[model samples]
Target: MQLASFSGFIKTLFYIIAFYYIFRFLAKLFLPLIVKKVVEKAGENMYQQQQRQQQSSWQKNQNDDTVIYNTDNVKKPRETKKVGDYVDYEEID
Candidate 1:
């Protein structure tokens, strides 16, 4: 009876160790696949979000009526005459 119990205990311990190693091996094999799928999904979601934002901005610009003209090459108005008069004065002591 003691020998039977000892064998059973040893069997259970062996099973536990086998299961732990199997789980670790499977995790090493599948973890990278899972992480790669998740990263691809996140990238697709970000790309879709960016596309939506660009589309919305384009639509908003189309719906607006304001016409913005570029003024980089436009010259400012030049003054015709000087307004302030020059006054000559000497310091008195």
Candidate 2:
């Protein structure tokens, strides 16, 4: 029969703790670079969108002709015949 040993347990525990610390150290080293790249990409996208909006507005300005319409004769609303009485619902307490 195999039995558990204290030294073996200690070794395993030490390895796990070491691996955790190393992972955290590496993340602290590289997380900022990753975040900075993401922010720069977002800024570039916003700049591109602004440029497109400006170009479209400039194109619209190039065609500034105003067309006027005459609305002197207009049709009036149709008259409705007699209908059923309206019933409004009341909320019960």
Candidate 3:
């Protein structure tokens, strides 16, 4: 089996360091933009929810001023029973 070379080890280490720095640079460049977009989206959703609540409240306010008349209480009268009452007799032993 062949032994690992020192130059190969150095080259691998160099690649790892290079990639780490590149990743950090890209993250610094894009992280703020990503966070800002997320914040704006959350704000938009909150605004939409507030708008929906306002519309629902507006409809409720309109309904509060309206009046309804009920005729059901006057239409139905008390029902009278036509059957006679029965008396039960007990037998004495």
The better-scoring model by TM-score among 1 and 3 is 1
Candidate 2 lDDT tens digits, 1-93: 988899999999999999999999999999999999999999999999999999997778778776545676777788998788899999999
* Highest-scoring model, lDDT: 1
What TM-score do all the candidates reach, one by one? Answer: 0.62, 0.56, 0.59
TM-score of 3: 0.59
Clashing residue pairs in candidate 3, if any?
none
Off by over 4 Å in 3: 1-3, 66-93
Per-residue accuracy of model 3 over 1-93 as CA lDDT, tens digit each = 998999999999999999999999999999999999999999999999999999997888788987656677786767999798898999999
lDDT for position 65 in model 1: 90
Worst 10 residues of 2 by lDDT: 64-73
Cα lDDT for residue 7, candidate 2: 98
Judged by whole-model lDDT over C-alpha atoms, candidate 2 comes out at 0.92
* Candidate order by decreasing lDDT: 1, 3, 2
Tens digit of lDDT per residue, candidate 1, span 1-93?
Answer: 345588898999999999999999999999999999999999999999999999998898899998867898899997798889999999999
- Measured with C-alpha atoms, the lDDT of residue 63 in candidate 2 is 82
